[model samples]
Target: LEGADGPGLFNAAQTLRQLVTRESSKGKGSKGDKGSRGFAGVTVRDWPASPVRGITEGFYGDAWSQQERLEQLDFLGRTKQNRYLYASTDDPYRQSSHWRDPYPAAQRAEFRALAERARRNHVTLGWAVSPGQGLCFSSDEDRRALLRKVDAMRALGFGAFQLRFEDVSYSEWHCDEDARTYGSGPKAAARAQAELANAVARHLSARHPGTEPLSVMPTEFYQDGATDYRSALAEKLEQGVQIAWSGVGVVPRTITGGELADARSAFRQHPLVTMDDYPVNDYAQDRIFLGPYRGREPAVASGSAALLSNAMRQPTASRVPLFTAADYAWNPKRYDPEASWEAAIDAVAAGSGTEEAREGAREAVHALAGNDASSLLGGRESAYLRPLLAEFWAAYDAADSDKKSEVKRLRRAADQLLDAFGTMRTARERVPDALEREVRPWLRELARRGEAGEQAVKMLTAQARGDGGAAWDARLALKQLRADGPERGAVVGKGVLADFEKRALETSERWAGVRRKAFGDQTVHGGPTARPDSPAEAAVDGDPDTAYRA
Candidate 1:
């Protein structure tokens, strides 16, 4: 807390978490009143170990622009996130200022409008100004550019600036690379960089009178475990300037152990900003959490959901960090990786009458939104698979011929499979209002269990990361839960409705397995794999249709 730019500040925020009532966390997402608050007399506890627990925007090219950035800022605020890293190639307003283009007449006005909206929502916007990279500023020029940028931000009302020192000399805005580089040694280089950056900080504070914090992106070479550059940078992290680390496992689209280790090392020096880790690779593509741009495409939505889910799973401890889902101008590096599908579902389900009705609607809608096994099983059975049988055969014939139509033939197979799955939407749409009402209770219970189950895992992991005694206690609690699985399992000793809920949650959990099984059934995609001999043989005896149809 002395300088207010270290882990201590982060610790203070964590302590603040315990001070907050449990109602806050649950209010964010917990269904009904049954949450951390319900279980005990509300004891809140949270702390971020890193200074910047964040995500970025404006990296993945021109895919995300002004409007998308605003929306993502709102989303970050809802999650209690505290930072925004704007790394776009082209400025939002398409103009430039020396140090920073005084928000320009157009850009400044845009920022002010965005700031008004952000302020209303309790979001503090941070700027990641990269003068050296895109601005073509030399070391001397950088001094001036920094001043201009700071002045511009000050004029527009911003308190923090992330100084990104990326060296891009090949482009049109290229500057003498060495003149702007952070140099070889961390100290000497840092000393020089700090002098320049500190001047900007001082100038901004003096000029704006409300100077925000500054975070400098560390040199890329610091990836080495024991490098002088890192040590110098750590030592030279000027009084007000923090360090930001690039999440490099991206690009190729991977977050490996080595990358995390490097991050931990750099974090030990000072709080670091994490970039390019959002819109997680749900489909395991190189790009993760890279976009929520140009409106909602289903593929993008699903991909964003996957990335958000993955980002949620990371054990990041940065305190004052931000997350963006915007793929600015289509640059993968600056994609906001925080989009919550679960939250989205909850949003859609809000105000849909009773809780049960809301939940039933959620499932139905989810079914329509996907092509997985769970979607297929939403209503009745696989009667639609029969129609695609001929198309499937044609794909097989195409595949066998020595024709050069491999991609097309494979695409044909995929189309037929999708055609079969499309039946889910038809069935979901046909679901009667009476049936929805009938299934409402089961759906609510299912949603509750699914959510609670995931939270239980998170809670245990959280406890494990805490003090030893608490960790041990959490361990025992998990063991007890496991032992009580028979009773704990949603369907165990339950009625027919309870059984259905259990299957639904399980199917959702094993979505991939369900998908494989659906295609692995008596179909061409089932190719060579042993198909379920009697998958559609209906149920076991006694009015099979009534078992699910009713």
Candidate 2:
């Protein structure tokens, strides 16, 4: 655990934790100090592919709680992510309106404590200040005000700083000084912004020597080719000051090596880093992307000076994808997104002691994550349920000569689908409470989706077995559930599961529309009658994860 810096030990500790599993917390109030590992007589020495592999809390909407920030810093350390940029766009002290002011005493205290936690986790704490909206780039007062803000932030243990111009207007200037000093248009805005960044970089170099190089998020952050703005920034911005680009769009689906090279070439050799905006759902606040990082070439990691993910509002739930992003950032060449995603799911779900079979939290988390495993980056939602639904449909659609045998086959398919829905129904109850809050809506939708599916399956199966009363009731319940199923923002199982239910409903309706007269008032048979205390319907119910009198 030796290095020129003190963080090496923290990293080594993280590595060691990965090598062992805690085995002792099976009992109530147990210390859980006991652990075991398969690896023996081994030493691991490692380094991340990218230098700044961490998060930028740079999303829109609500800022994270103080506890969330602290937890995020710890997560970064655990994953060997060495930097954490504090830049929640909604945080008053972080943006244009309040960039000149200091944090309140309470927030300042929180920042100091965050810094200490970051230090313990081997994370470099950085703060981003967006002053472009109100800054007169040419004004002496604005320049010093920005610097004073930086100094104040530094005093609270921010080791690095980023200047954000991503949200500012290109045609407008904050003061008359900006139009007078730099002239007008995109090129002028670029030139002015570059000079301001240069001032801050030089100031940091002189006063805070050896701290991380200053970074700037350009107004033309994700643009292609060499524009007037790019050219001006290329020529004027200090070389050591990092340029942050968010791929080719605010949240692009793909970022290739060639595209990155092109963007770097456009910027003309300033140190370039990617502030990849995956898993950040600020624009679409209804979702959380739990998929593994994808569509990035290996060189995207090796080529960048650093790679930072913009995190979601939900800190704990954000770990699912952020973990994969960190894994890719550390070693992109060997990354397998699916495998990494599964491991990440395990790592996160394991925290809530969700290790049981069937309705356990692990499967529940998988359902929750798999159903939400999509974002701007592009992934299949309901990945876990898709195959199960397919299997059910395959069996349901199979052509069978024997009626009873076919009913048996269809029932088997329906049962598997129902079991999966069971997991989805109870997903929220299984995870940690904090994580539950962030994902409660999704979990609720998942449960609703599952319940709707179960009703559809039951309705179809009941009709198949010539049970008139049961089939009618199940269909009625299913219709009502479907009516209630239109969630405002949160979606689970996406379209496919709904399609399956829709098809089932249509097939049942179709059968009803073309039914024979049942050969002169014959009685229809159904499943076993229910006892009063435990209704037969309890078996198909969403919760308790158990069948009635099975």
Best by lDDT: 2
Model 1 / residue 138 / CA error / Å:
6.2
Identify the runs in model 2 with alpha carbons over 4 angstroms from their true place: 1-5, 22-45, 353-359, 399-408, 514-550
Instruction: Provide the clashing-pair count of each candidate structure.
Output: 44, 0
TM-scores across all candidates? Answer: 0.46, 0.88
**Which pairs of residues collide in model 2?**
none
List CA RMSD, all candidates: 19.5, 7.7
Reference-based lDDT, residue 16, model 2? 74
* Residues 120-144 of candidate 2: C-alpha lDDT, one tens digit per residue: 8888898888888878898898899
Weakest 10 consecutive residues of candidate 1 by summed lDDT: 312-321
